[model samples]
Structure formats: C-alpha cells, structure tokens
Target: MRQLPKLSFWQIWNISFGFLGVQFGFALQNANASRILSNLGADLHHLPLFWLAAPIMGLIVQPIVGHVSDRTWNRLGRRLPYILGGALVSMLAMFMMPNASMVVAWMAPVLFGAIIFALMDGSFNVTFQPFRALVADMLPDEQRNVGYSIQSFLINAGAVIGSILPYVLTNMMGVSNEAPDGQVPQSVIWSFYIGGAILIISVLVTVFKTKEYPPAEFNEYKNISEAEQQEKQSFWVTLRSMPKTMVQLAVVQFFAWFALYLMWVYTTPAVAQHFWHTPVGDAGSAQYNEAGNWVGIIFGAYSLFAALFSIAMPWLAKQWGRKTVYALALLAGCLGFVSMYFLTNPNHLIVSMIGIGIAWAAILSMPFAILSSALPAKKMGIYMGIFNFTIAGPQIISGLLGGTILKTFFDGQAIYILIVAGVSMLLGAIAVYFVDDIHAKSH
Candidate 1:
C-alpha cells in the first residue's frame, strides 16, 4: 500500500465527526436514564442498579476490542469497522431504550431496556478505545492536542443537543407528559428516535470518508519484529503483568470516574429536589422536565468550557507542567461539586458546571495523552483497553456504593451524592501529582 499524506484539519474534523453523534446518544442517555427509570416506576434506591450497563460494558468489552483491533488489518482498516459496527448497535439500542416501558405486564420493561443498553454500551466502548489509539497512531505529538480538543468539542456539542431534545419534543411538539403510572412521556420517546438517526449518520461519515495508515507501520513497537508476533507474550500474560503506570492510573481513575458517575446520576434529582422543589410524579408541572433540561444546559456549559480548556491544556502543560494543570482542573471540579450544595436558584448552577467542565476536558484528554507516551506502541490497543478499566471500575464501584450512601445517609436525597462526588474529585486531583508523564515538561 502507498503511504498516505497526513490528514488536513478538515480530514481530522471528518474522522472525529462521529463522536458528535455518539455523545448525543450518550449525553441524552446519561443525563436522563435515571429519570426515565424513575418514571417507569423504579424506586429511587434502585436507580443505581439500572444505571450499571455502562461500566459493566466498558470493563468487559474494551480490552477484548483493543486486542482484536491490535491484530486486525482489513479493507476497512483497524478501527473503522469496529466503529461502524458499534454505531449500528448503539442506534438500535437507543431506539429501544425510550420504548422500554411498553413491555407487557409482569415483565420488567425497564430491565429489558437496561439489558439492551448493556449490549449497546459495550459495543460502543469496544470501538471507542481503538478509536482513541488510532488518534495516537495517526497524529504527530504536536497536533495531538488539537485533535483531542476537536473531539472534546464534538462530544460536548453532541451532548448539549441530546439533553435538550426531550424538552423540545415535550414543550414544543405537544407530546403527552403523563403516561399513567408505569409508562414514559412521549417527549423522551421522540428524543431517542432522533438521537438514533443522528448516531448512525455521524458514524457512517467516518466509515465512508476516512482512510487509515497501513498495519505494518502501526505494529513497529520499540522497533520489534512482527515476525515473532506469536512469540511475544500473550494478552493473558500481559494482563497478569500490567505496567506500574497503568496500575497507578487505575487507582486515580477509580476515584475520578466515581465522582463523575455520581454527578451524572444525581444532578437531575439534586436540581429537582433542591432547586426546583418538586417531586418525580408531579402532574401538570414542568419542574421535573425543566430541571432535566437545565441539567443539559449546565452540562453544555461545562462542555463549552471543556472544549476551550482542551486547547489551553497542552500549552498550559508546556508552561506549568501536566501535573500542575491537572491538579488545578480537579480543584475546579471539586469546587464546582461543592457549590451545588449552596445553589438556591436554578440559573446559578451554570457557575458550578464551568468548573466541572474544566475537569471533564482534562480527564478525557490528559489521561490518554499521558498513557499513549508511556505504553508500548504495538500493544497500544490492548493497553488502552486495559487502561479503560480504571474508568469503568470506579463507575461500577460508584454504582454500588453511591446508592448505599444516598439511601443510608441522605434519605435517598441526591444532594449527598454530589457531596461524595466532590470529595472524590478532590481526591483524584491529589492523585494526579503522582502520575509520571514523560512527555510533560519538567517543572
């Protein structure tokens, strides 16, 4: 195969375009899944159980997909095929999730949607890790910051649109807000359908338009021979002997993701109870859906900041160093989470999201940038997959424990969840100082 020229700005934009759709799907789901579950008659205490699909899928699918992508070299290239396949699955799952309450009597439809959600989420992560690695493989170091920033922008932008879709459908389209005691609102159903179509189209753009680097170039890890590919240590062996960096990163990731999971899960409830002063089943009231939409608006604000900060981070790292910049970002998130406790008006919530958004941008980009430099190139996919365990594992822990805290300590109120999340973010910031980024400028 002939050597392809480096991608232009537009090329990078096109390749990264799918995430816009992916985030749209994910943002809508993440911001509202718990709300949807509650509307379907799930207890507040059991909400965490229903939200378990994401971390579970990430834990199981990422490494396997990473390993497969490492060895894959086909007509569609290494990562695009996985991307395409995942997009299709996620779209179908998105469509099903909103309609889950339609299940017949005696069968838990929410549970059914949760299962399909697991499948979709798992498939998406399988494709996601490889896609991140592909960026590392394709871009030179200088351009990586730009590449990732564009991605962050798309992620937040997509989420903003997704989160607001339900509000648009319900308020503007005259959708039914009430659905007896066991069904979902028509607005949410419309959001999922719209999200599904957008998801498929965005992913297909990359599948059809972008070309990938040849496999031989990707496999030249430490200048080692691919001839002894089998002679090299097996994945199980590598799994047994993980690098120290991955181990430490995992420790930090546990706390970081835990905090984030809490924020996403509880933001709506916290806003509804604390800010809006409303309950889930309040009729003829827009408070719940309005609070939900405000969460989207708040999330979008953070994402807007995150996209801007993603650009500044690389430069900031060049000056004060990665550790310091990351530390500051975490501190900002901590402050943001803490501020939620003091928020009286709904509009004031935007102030908190700005800090969380800074942390969000860094968490998404800096960790990958740090890991890519330290990991073995030939095993990039597998290690990246393994690296994802840090992200997924904490989420699982949070899913289990966050519920316990909410029920036992706070009487199922969501404010306490944000408090725990704030502490977790602060703890994660402390851990960042210890991470050794080789490419990061010396202080």
Candidate 2:
C-alpha cells in the first residue's frame, strides 16, 4: 500500500483558500438573510419557515455533489470543478438575494426570499462538500488536523469580512442603511455585490493555484485497485457500514446545529426587540434597520474571534483531547447564548460573542478532524457529504418546529428562543462526551 504524501504548510493553505470565498457567501446570508426577510415584511412567526429552504437544499445537494465529485476527474481537477461552478451560482444568488422584494411586485417577498435563499445555500453546499474532501485528498493523517484547522480559520476570516461589510458600508462609507417601506437598504445591496465579487475571485485563486493528484496516482495513494475505483458503491451500502464514531458524532451535531439554527433565525429580531426596542411589525423603521446592522457587527466579532481561535485548536486538541475540548467549547457557547438575555447594551454583546466564537471554531474544525481519521480515503467525498446530513437535518427540524414553538410557548418573544438555544447547546455539550475520538486516541 502506498502512503499519501504529507503537504507543506503553503500547499495546505493553497488547497484551503477557496473556503474563504465560500464562507463569504455564507456569512452574508447568516448575517443578513433574516434581516432581508424581515425587511420584506415577513412575520416573525413565519421567519423560520422561510429560512427552511437553506437546510433543505443543503441536505439534498451536498450528498449528490459528493457522490458526483468522487466519480469525477477533469483537467480543472476533481474538486475545483464543483468549487468554481458553485461559486458562480452563489455569486449570482448573492446579487439577487437582496433584490428579491423588487424582482416581482406581485410575488410576496417572503416567498421570493425563500427561493433565493435556497439557491444560495444549494450552491454553497455544492462548493463546500468538495472542499472537505479536498483536505482528505491532499493531506496524510498526521496533517489532516492542521489542514482542517486552516480551513476553519479561513472560513471564519472570510465570514468576518462578509459579516462586517454591510455595517462598514453603512457607518463608515455613509451609505444609507434605511430603505423606504418594502425596499432593501443600499448598504445591504452593496455588501452583497462586493461579497459576490470577492467570492468569485477567491474561488478562482484556488482553482488556478492548487493542483490535485491525478486519478491513477490518487488510487495508488489510497491503496485501492483500479477495478475497485471503477466500481460504484451504492450510497446505502456505504452508509450502512459507517464507523461507530460517525454515528456518535451525529448525535452531537444534531443538538449543536439545532442551537445554531435558533440563533441564526431569531438573533435579528431578538436584538431588535431587546436592544433597540423596535416592534416586530415595524420592519421599515430606521431603528429596526439600525438594530439589524448591529447584528452584522456582532456576527463579525464572533467570526473574527473564531478565525483567531481556530489557529490554536490543533494545539488545544493535543493538550486536552478533541472530545473534551469540543464539549467545553459547546458549554462556552451555551453561556454565550444565555448571556444575550442579560445584555441591555448592543456593544456588550461582544462579550457573549467571545464565547460563541470559541464554540464556532471548535464546530468548524473538531468534527472533521476526528471524522477524517476514521473514514476510508477512497470514500472520503461521500462520507463527508453524508456527514452534512447531521448538520442540515437538525437545522431542517429546527426550522420546521422553531416558529411554532415560539408562537405557542414563548408568545412570539424572540428572546426566549435564544434561551432555548442555550439549553440545546448545553445538551450538545454533554452529547460530545460520548464521541470516540480516534485521532486523539491514536496520538
């Protein structure tokens, strides 16, 4: 059996740089999508349902992209093709997403936003799943942790820039943050345009700069026969034979993602109501838009912290064990969410974000680091894609149930949603204790 070669630090960085752009698209969505939906007159109760499109699209698209990328090989390389194609689609979606309310006067904004959200998310998943497999493809086991942490670092770095774009456009550049009734803000519009352009350029850099091993060479590295490589395995067969660690990690992923989904769907409204005293029905109010931009700043803070903290994750894992570090990170995130209930000032939210940032860094790197060691190299793409189901499935369930839970139990107060997220994150922390960390054990 031939061993895969270790990648240089620069080579690992080149392979991971495309994630910077993919995440720019995601950060823009995460920071602004709910604000956009609310601006278009979406009721708070139905907001989660509108957000549902993202996870649903991700659940369906990632596994298919993974399966196809596994079989695919071309001059642009196996993963770059999907990366570039998805970048193009995401760029288009970003440009159109903020304009959703204006595209059709008769179509409801909520419905239009849902369609655009799905497109952006679908494209992101197509691009994202390949990147996960790329790390496994290019790096040996000893370096996989470093490769994934670098990817996480770049992901959060891009998110920081993307999350802050609107705020910078509004506050720094003096662009108008408030739009007329039923219209999107100029600051948000420009942010999306800039984010889209950056998304393309960053992905193109990875496409042209990074090289992939040829299929024959890749097969040799993985120790798979040409006949075995040629034969397609059914998804079910591969899924049924999944390692125990994958199943255990899935439980952790479920509650963690469920907590995150609540934060993403409710944070805008919660902040607007709690900090700015903006009413839920008054989407077009200047105070409401100001609160939305503040959410962007808070998102940027957390992302910036995540980028800085991710650099230390490999070292932290070595010292504390991956499972323990991950569990502690989730506990910190729980406190972050719970802290939101007590903050009266918007700027003070940064303290809460510090905790969330630690968790975000862990969430991005730890699972992939552990999972990569357990998965077969030949089936890396499919397994990575399957792992996304754990992410998207919980999000889908949260989207379906969140609005109802808010309306029935919380009396439509978004603040209570954050409390629920805090509790869910605490449960996730406990669940992570059960995951078998093969990498940690081996070390």
lDDT of 1 by residue, 26-77 (tens): 8888877877777666677777777777998898898888888877889999
lDDT of 2 by residue, 16-133 (tens): 8989988988999998998898888787888888888888988899889988898899999998899999999999999999998786667887678778889999999999999999
Residue 277 miss distance in model 1 (angstroms)? 2.1
List candidate 1 segments past 4 Å from native.
1-6, 172-176, 220-222, 279-286
Residue pair clashes in candidate 1: none
- Clashes by residue pair, model 2: none
Assess candidate 2 and give its TM-score to the true structure.
0.98
Off by over 4 Å in 2: none
lDDT score of model 2?
A: 0.90
Where is model 1 poorest over a 10-residue stretch in terms of lDDT? Answer: 279-288
